[model samples]
Target: MPISHQKALPSPIRVVLLNKPFQVLCQFNDEQGRQTLADFIHEPDIYAAGRLDRDSEGLLLLTNHGPLQHRLAEPSQKMPKTYWAQVEGDITEQALQQLQHGVQLKDGLTRPAKSQKIAPPKLWERNPPVRFRQNIPTSWLSLTITEGRNRQVRRMTAAVGFPTLRLIRVQIGPWKLTSLQPGESRDISGDPQIATLLKSPKRKSYRSPRSPQR
Candidate 1:
């Protein structure tokens, strides 16, 4: 049966947010060969709102709601997302300014962003802790972006000469990582505001022009 016909069935779309863990592939298949979201979310017919990279860890939204999914994932929408990054060198005032103004990349210049130095973070142990080079010092930074480009944060930090060692997304629009730990999943039925945010807007009614009477 076609998906449109299957709509008569009982299951309805719902919204979900997940804190994606490092090393897990964004997809459900293992053909290319790696752990995937299928290892976490098990609900039938559900899909992710957007994606996070396999090497990156943090807040990811998922939903069965199609319109909500399109709205969040579409590049034109430019949803805001914040990240905490640990980079390879000391964070200088000049470096912070450059990041705020936007760095040019092969794709073109990024939009202006908000950035600042942050205190060292206490995070879950990465399976293979990033390689250590004693001569180079590391510092923590907070950065936010309105666009979700491919490996964008990492590329941005590297463009500024501070290769990111650790990257964790902390916020997206109004959603937050809060208390959820990596590798864990949850159903988000408790928050009404979140529910409303995820709900699809009602479509406008249409009327046809009247035909001549016999």
Candidate 2:
């Protein structure tokens, strides 16, 4: 049978969903020799869709589909990702509004994004909790954006005077961090809506997606 004549699989090839834990670098290797997805995802050829900082935690998607991977990681496409941030002080309504409008960063003004205070989400225990100051208070804020600027979440919080102490990604496009706890993972069959967004043309002034650290 000709290659084009072969029957297609029942579904799109599956993508790996990893609840990337804190302190695990995004790359396969580190000069400091820390763990990475390679420690868990032994499957070959697949690459990370986007990046989650070593200090940050939560959903990180991986896949072998090149076009889909490029679309997800590409800044031009602006696929929204949601993150839950634990900051060092109470978050005010004004601060959330400022975030939604846009904030000035050293690089430039960030694009408008969504942000709101959220009740502390019940999460799996981190191996080591964030440090405490005897008098300092904290709050949780849920933020979502299409652009994945480097350290953008931390920078955005700091720009508004609430430095983030912990960050967890709760959603990527249509996929959520639901059910999959820290250090656990599952396979996503695929979603057509997300695929449509991925296939769209790259936006002007979009920063090209770089390969994940590893």
RMSD of each: 9.7, 4.5
- TM-score of model 2 (CA atoms): 0.86
Model 2, runs deviating above 4 Å: 1-12, 190-214
Task: For candidate 1, give the lDDT of residue 44.
Answer: 78
Q: What's the TM for model 1?
A: 0.84
Give the alpha carbon lDDT tens digit for every residue of 1-214 in model 1.
5656545565565767787888998877889778899988888788888888899998888877777787777655667899999999998888889889987776677778999999997888887888868899999999998776678899889998899998899888877888888977667646575567556464343211231121
Positional deviation of residue 69's Cα in model 1 after best superposition, in angstroms: 0.5
TM-scores of all models? 0.84, 0.86
Please give the CA lDDT of all the candidate structures: 0.80, 0.84
Give the Å shift of residue 88 in candidate 1: 0.3
Clashing pairs in 2: 27-214, 28-214
Q: Locate the minimum summed-lDDT window of 10 residues in model 1.
A: 205-214
Q: Of the candidates shown, which would achieve the greatest lDDT relative to the real structure? A: 2
lDDT of 1: 0.80
